[model samples]
Target: MRYLKYFILVLPIVIALEAQAQEEDCAFKLREAQQLYDAGRIETIPEMLQACLERGFTQEDRLAAFKLIILCQIYADDLEKAHAGMLSFLKRYPEYELTTTDPVEFRFIFEKYRTRPILDIGAFAGVSLTHGLISQPFTPFNLNNAKPKYTSDGFGFQAGALFNFYASSNIQISLEPMYAQSNFQLVYEQEPIEGIATLDHHEKQSYLYIPLSGTYEFIIGKFRPYARLGFQLGLLFANNTSSSGIFEGPDEDNLENRNQLNYWVFGGGGFKYKLNKSYIFVDLRYNVGLNQYLVSPDKRFTQPNHNWVYMYQDSDFRLNSFMISVGYARSFFNPKRVN
Candidate 1:
């Protein structure tokens, strides 16, 4: 009884001491990784961070550790892991960036995701250029032009992500959701008018795009060839920034009545290749809009006194793009901070 009492009393103290020791070790490791990164010695930071991760730190520690890992991955020129990492993180923590106080730091992480090993991500800063073949019909042009139902060029920007379950290195089942914005002018004229009424306009669409695709990848050394079949779900985000009404010209009117979102079905395919620690990616996809720009009851989908959103729901915006996104990624664990 006496021995048991003494053992019990000492065990808590011993355990507490051991825990403190482990925490100090993790703190030391994290500091070391940050220092090395600050010093621009990136390659070794991962190793050190991984050591700390393996030591089983708290959740906050793990989060910080992953951030370091991501930076190391970017510096090391590993894109495959970067893309996969972005997808994984966003899916798990979609609004993690929104919750942070330091948006600039968060942006650094995003810029890291957008940058390529061969090309700077900053080059594609505002616009991400892309090209993909249409395996499915993604064209949203009106055989007849109305308010929002019309055609432009075949290329713009597919600025969202496509999801896929990789069955294997060469095969994956895909569910890709993307978003894009396009600014263009619109012309509207009633087919049978008493005299002649014409309207010239400009508008933009923010689409909530979703595509269901099956991707078949062919691996030849570092080269990858893939195919896809899917459609897009477009949601309207905004309308004409500046426009003219039916009675005036571009400089003479404000046409807020002609904004809408549209949906469509389209498909395509493309190829990608890998580099030492990065990748080069490209694709060509087509968009086919299924609905009209505005229904019959509302010409231009306009209201007597306000914007179109309050009058009626907007259809999917008729906008598609040929997209190219490049990414790099790597895995790391580091206990020393290097610059």
Candidate 2:
């Protein structure tokens, strides 16, 4: 009789522990799916999560698992699977509402699948025209009071995605996250004492950039003219500097003249030609740098003024660029007009 009573007391505890362990297992599986998705393993997620979605122990786990599967399918370019998954999700959770925490891309796709709007997701690539401006102390070593000089023009290219959010008939917000290859040339000229008179330096840099702009449109027949005002941020990734003449030393890599980060305020006007739901655009913009491009060193050079070029130098230099780009994009979501 005493053993029977003990058995009765332990049975409920064992059952509860088993249930808890099952719940934990389900949570772990869902987390694993999320990890794979976040790690850019889009193609692997569907297979890895099939079992979890089929056997989800709770409503939250099933919902999360389904969403992951649908997202993975969309990224993998399997639109048919994505559409089917989304339909199934809606059928399962008819009252579920999307939150702000969800990925904007996913929300955009879902809205397109439901109620369409004038939304665009586009990719663009174009050439760039950059003019570098360097400002120093006007001959810090009192060489001649000559201002810093730059190349006439350096050429590069930029590529990125353009997401256009149309608010109304005459207004839209265009956000572009891009990668740019910017190259520049700097020249330091001195008295022609020898063959090595001018120090010509060329720098090639890579940056990740994003430009957010508010645009206004004026329709004229088939062409739409628009103007935009915005700011851009550029994060430098890699820099390579090469020199010739007097500036050429054993160390060709000079970290002293490079800036790791840069930003600019920009404005421009452009025109677009409409063709059904797709359009081609050409934009011309000017960018002005807001900060110094070089860092000042702590140590000073006590050597002769001629050797001053090798020492740490400070300058008030800024970047400016005139860019002309042309690309095409399509409107994927166009909402119905209410009359």
Candidate 3:
């Protein structure tokens, strides 16, 4: 009877020691998960601590585990689970504050999914430079005498809006629609033919430009630098030209019609700075045309008296330009959340 009473007294103490050991083990597992996450071994944490998260952790440790799981989901591209985890977090701790040690990736996902949209809108305005290229027709037994010259300072203006779609943290696609006015001066250089000297002319054009581009960006703090490449389609709305002091209007008013459809490939780089929920950006770009322009036979200075037998003639003349612009943009989200 005396030994039986001693056994009963020691049983509760032994049970308490075993419970303490189990709790210590759970804490160790939680700490290990955190270390793995900090070391960028996110793929390993779920396999290692998923069971411990459900088994023996305290309330504080459980909260930390859930936060880590959310982060892991984001990194793993498991957005659906990350969103659900965020909902759970908000329900449990409605007033939780993010600390400085939080990862930037986490903040980006949280802000976008919780408050902003995947699309951004941008606006800009800047100067443009237009260059005209002229080449001789390929033929046998022909002299390369007729040369078309252009003024080097063909300055212009451009203004536009950029519709940006975010594909990832470092990449986006932009569709820009803009209006531009360009100016140029044309000169013909050739040896004196029939006592005629060189001729000078002027041209001014207005176009609607549409461009689609892909951008890759590098982010540092509130500033971002990006490179973009794209193709643009231009539709001529108005064109006016004067040769040897005689004036000729566009297709609508002139006897011969000029090429109204222009397409080219463009590339550029720029920088963006964050301002509240909006961004301010600056861009510079160059465009190269693929097709030549068709000039009117009546205005061909090389054969000045050439009758208008044909309205348009194919010439090895192309258009190239440079552009720079500045703009502002902001993000929007649906299902608005209360701040």
TM-score against native, each model: 0.41, 0.57, 0.58
* RMSD to the hidden true structure, all candidates: 17.8, 17.3, 17.2
**Candidate 3 per-residue lDDT over residues 254-315, each given as its tens digit:** 21345688889999999999776678999999988766655443344443222122112224
Candidate 2: tens digits of C-alpha lDDT, residues 176-215: 9999887776555643334536555566777898888888
For model 1, the stretches where C-alpha displacement exceeds 4 angstroms are 1-149, 153-158, 187-199, 245-261, 276-278, 295-339
Deviation (Å) of 338 in candidate 2: 5.8
lDDT of 2 at 261: 74
Where does candidate 3 stray beyond 4 Å? 1-100, 103-117, 137-146, 188-198, 245-256, 295-314, 333-339
Q: What is the C-alpha lDDT of each candidate?
A: 0.50, 0.69, 0.70
lDDT of 3 at 65: 80
Ranking by lDDT: 3, 2, 1
| Ranking of all candidate structures by their TM-score, best first | 3, 2, 1
| Candidate 2 global TM-score | 0.57
The positional error of residue 250 in candidate 1, measured at the CA in angstroms, is: 8.7
Q: Please say which candidate is ahead in lDDT: 1 or 2.
A: 2
